[model samples]
Target: MNANVTAGEAPPRAGRREWIGLVVLALPTLLLSLDISVLNLALPHLSAALGATSTEQLWIVDIYGFMIAGFLLTWGTLGDRIGRRKLLLIGAACFGAASVAAAYASSPEMLIAARALLGVSGATLMPSLLALISNMFKDPKQQGLAIGVWMSCFMGGMAIGPVVGGALLGSFWWGSVFLIGLPVMLPLLILGPVLLPEYKAPEAGRLDLLSALLSLATLLPVVYSVKTIAAEGVGAKAIVALLAGIAFGVAFVVRQRRLEHPLLDLGLFRNRALRAALGVALLASATMGGITLLVSIYLQQVAGLSPLAAGLWLVPSFVLAIIGNMAAPGLAARINPAFVIAGGLLVTTVGLLLLTQANSPGGIPVLVAGYAIAFAGTSPLGVLSTQLVVGSAPPEKAGAASALSETNGELGIAFGVAVLGSLSTAVYQSRMTDAVPSGVPGTAAEGARDSLPAAADAATSVPADLGTQLLDAARDAFAGSLHVVAVVAAVAMVLYAILAVVLLREVAPAGGAEPDAEAGPDSRAGVQEDAAARR
Candidate 1:
């Protein structure tokens, strides 16, 4: 550890007030996650009400995520210059205002704009909350527990979002889904200043506008290109966009290396623990994201479940995810976190294998079982890996570090949906094309080959007997595609597990003491010094 720190001794424990503040901080996480899932369920209703074209519908959903991914680094580093609490409060206000605007939006363009604003505001919340947790809970064990609780809330939001959307859509309009954020944000904004402590980097300098622009340029094109490749397939435009993003990314890194006060510290990645933890987090998220997309499509399109029924079916997995997040810290307290992460990945691989058994419409139960096991296994990895990523960074750099972690998560989800989802779709289309009846009209046949949803729509325009044959063939082909994707996902999980074991072999448990002082102050002295100051 740095010469300024003490080792072996535990850091200060959070007081009752600090614990309560954690709950306050979690409100934004809950709302942000809820927004992501709820909108998917509301898409049908919103599409009809706003008279949205298919392209506009895609934009409405895609813009929010794209904006969030692009702005995370900017907001995270900005929080370090201006206090985390201050940035969080501002974000809360903007998020709440955007929600109201979204609820009342009358046109597709307006709704898309409102969702983009929500994404911009949301970028300010996640990193700030995570960094705050690091500052509040100084002890290694308590910090693990705190991060677990924070992650649990995020998972809980995802679990309940569909159910909440189902209920709202049943009774009111689709806009009511946006209203949910208002209640959550109201309390956070009211009590945040009264209860939450403020922290900022003491020696932080002026914000680098060029670096911020470069970061956005680097991330947005890559994400957009992946999305384009998924929807439209690989082409010259997508290839160029990808190359441009890589070029900008390289330039950003080089600029950071030369800057005295960089937006993201290049030195942080030098730590073996931090580097490995980030990699694990990214891969785990990608797997979970892909699995979620596949399951949602399978349940609704293949099994013919209504939105409400599908959401209800997903409840068990969500509950198990929460359980896994809560249990990870205690398990890691006894065993090394590396083993815990590796074991979780192994369990997830088994779950993926179980999904391969879902070969028919009646296999809904099998899908549910597989998803629950996979979600439970993967949830703990998220909590523990996130803890490792944040905890390994110096206290002053917590916001930037946390931002990097969250950015990786967004990218992982994007890649999962783009790559894995695309792979499944490609298989589905090829199989679907073969399954289409010989006498079907060209338009109907083309529509059926696009997707299950398109096939369902196309079925309505055809003769009753032909429609039945078409639907059956489409569902069967989709099921085959699902099986293929499951196998691919399982193989990916195995690789991730091996990587976790190899990379984190020497990483200690979350409950273990800090790194030894003899290792030198540059490694962990900043964290120990901050804890000492708080005490």
Candidate 2:
């Protein structure tokens, strides 16, 4: 009788049916992140083949991210109002076609244009997948685990993309990376509509066209401005662009507050768990995204490892990341999330601290150990915070909830690059100024340093002592800057731990109601009650 009752009580969980759904859903996340990672390894080939100049190379690498970041909120909200599967189908088609264009492009400009289109298509799928996953998993433990697994795939794609790209580049041409996604995506396109159930926005109001435009206006410039600052320097032009972005961003926020049906319901921030989780996510992003790029440089440039070898070094960190991520739900089930999050921050800080000590000679081992420890700490933080944000939001606001989580993530990435990445460049330039005896002018030095891979290549042809001086200066400068970045990350993680404690409620055990399904402002009776109490 008890068994029958338990079977009857099963709350429409994602059965074998939804497992298939998850595989399809994971495709875009994999591809989007894959595209982002593959380009770094492929940049040399792209430049050589297409005659891509420095600025053009930056565009080729960054346009995809900017377009996706700019359009994510708009697309996610639209999917909610329109229909996730419908948009997913449309996005898949556009993505596949753009992949073809990107693969075949003879010029960098054409490839950049194609990549931008791919970004637009990519933006639509992320929110749909998160929301679909939320709806499918009826059990809280499963919901948390599924989200973790989804996130693991995202990081895994980013981690392995270069390895795949390396193998491809060795075997084929520059376009192969762009072509790889097509076969994987084809199956998702065919099976998605037939298998995934249809879901409507809880309140599918007419599309908020103005708010969408405002989002694009604010986020695009801000993201672009930051990328520029990270790649170049904090010059007058970068500052001006950043100010303009901030101005538009303030305007966008004001407009959202005034609208009856805002593109995103910003009031969702009132939820304590949601807000705290966002804070944790932003800081985690800062640490992970900042270190990943910075360390990749350290691994390849300073440690003098091959592209393939550097990627291989990343395996330990990624493995630890997966383990750290999977541990979160289980830990949350037993303890207050405050302690759990604080513990994660503390653990990550230890790793960052170890990373900071890598400024010394023979520091590669320290770097790897630090990276592994920090990766373990951070791997779970993103997924756990994602769960919290969704848990805090009402189910109807899943679109908004997911978008907001991702916004923090992207912003964290942007800010990390701007702050930590800038510090690295500045330190490198300062230390290397007099160290290189090659008599290269400041302008020449800056230009040479712009593409470090090319610089390393250039070093091979110069006089032996001059080459050693240039390489050593570049190496030492990068190491010093990495130390600064590690310190900053450690500080941020420590601050985030304190905030998580003050803000997040004691996490209840896992056997309770699924957090993501009805945890938002639009769905949960508890949140509604809490609001009423506050009023």
Candidate 3:
């Protein structure tokens, strides 16, 4: 009757030991998310210390994500073969070692290399941890709650990353930010094996090297293109990268279909609930990611708050998001998950609507309020969508399913930042060009139009009256752009809300039938058997 040894009969409900293991699994999820945002606050310090060129700075920030996205599929599948707990421990060791290297990196190139290594290691953690959760929590209700807790830790990490970074930067050096991962990871390395169950797919197939290469070829170019478009706009390089990614992607799909034992089971997408859940998660993450970028800029540039202050202001959103994440499972238990998702999206839409009213100089309160409401409302979808995706798949394929969930989330954020960030940048430039002072130097005007931070820097080199004019104009233009983006985000939420309702209407309640009742004969039977085993 051991929870970890469930075999013939129904999987037992998770007990105290499993719950403790859940906490251990959450450690890496939190650290990975924290790593994504922590560096943003320390960039200035690191840039100064390393004497990084603008291009190098971009690489330092981007290479980590590119590596993570590129390697997720390979690592996920590897986990299923090698053992999830084994991969998790291996990743933890690598992450810790990479963090130390990154912390003391003396040159820009070294830092970039360390970050890439960190990303590669980080890729192994997410899917392994999530799949472990699927193996640990047998009861659907407990599974829902555990996933909620897991997701909330991730959100919390992202939310507090800036604060942690700011506090560390204020007291220590930029290197300290990277070192923070060490302590979080240490406990995981020690406790993960002792408290957690090790699970892997039975008779998992060989690790296909070609499929791994194809996945990397497909994802790296696409992500790079998106980042380029965000930073440099549409160009020949971006177009080429995009096209190449698409070509490789098509090949990857064909390869997956042909392989007797593919790296990923493409058949999982045929499940309506799973497909829609991924769509919901993608759009939600996209919307939130774009808004997060805009909000951070707005706080620092337009509102003129310090990094620490802005981080403090964002605390409420994080707290509310935690509440919402925890509340979502219970809500889904009572109502249909589709209704819960739609309701959350609608709430986010309303919050976005509220954001549209924010204007320059005095908009901080409105912005904060709007962010809190939107984050709280949208938070539930992350937990619920992830649950549906992972829950729908057979337990043996949980690692692959979890990897897909993480991959989609990463893509959503990348695209969201690219598209919406570009939109806002265009609007800001247009507004700033017209509003620039009459006798300002061409260099100053160009710099000011690029971004509010650049504008503030440019202001310092001008006459007092000109500096005031330039700063005011830049802030106003940015605020105007924020309004436009908020409206666009609101519209997107509305559309996605409708899609969620229509697509997920038949999604079963927690502990009920499989989400994909209409799957293929083989998949349907496997899903049902898996569900029954858990019950």
Candidate 3 to truth, TM: 0.95
Give the lDDT ranking, best first.
3, 1, 2
TM for every model, in the order presented, reads 0.95, 0.89, 0.95
lDDT of each: 0.86, 0.75, 0.87
Better of 2 and 3 by lDDT: 3
Q: Report the lDDT tens digits of candidate 1 across residue range 1-535.
A: 1111245555677899999999998888899889988998899999999999999999999999889999999999999999999999999999999999999999999999999999999999989999889878877778878888898898789888888888898899989999999999999999999889899988889889999999999999999998888777888988999999999999999999899989988877877777888898888888788888889889989999877788889889888888888898888888888889889988998888899898666999999999889888997689888888787777788899889999999999878887888888899999986899877899999999999888998888999899988998999988888888888988988899899889877776654545533333454657566656766
Off by over 4 Å in 2: 1-12, 359-362, 429-463, 511-535
TM-score-wise, the better of 2 and 3 is: 3
Look at candidate 3 and give me any clashing residue pairs: none
Better of 1 and 2 by TM-score: 1
The parts of candidate 1 lying over 4 Å away from their true place are 1-6, 513-528, 531-535
What does candidate 1 score on TM?
Answer: 0.95
How far residue 484's Cα lies from its native spot in candidate 3, in Å, is: 1.0
Tens-place lDDT per residue, model 3, 1-535, is 0112223444468999999999888888899988887888888899999999999999999899999999988898898888999999999999999999999999999999999999999999988988899889877678889999998998899888988888889899999999988999999989987998888877788998999999999999999999889878999999999999999999999999999889998988877778888988898898888998899889988998877688888889989999999999898877888889889989998888888888889999999999889989987788888888887777778888889999999999999999999999999999987788877899988999888878999999999999999999999999999889999999999888898889887765676544354555546656555646545
Each model's total of backbone clashes: 4, 8, 0
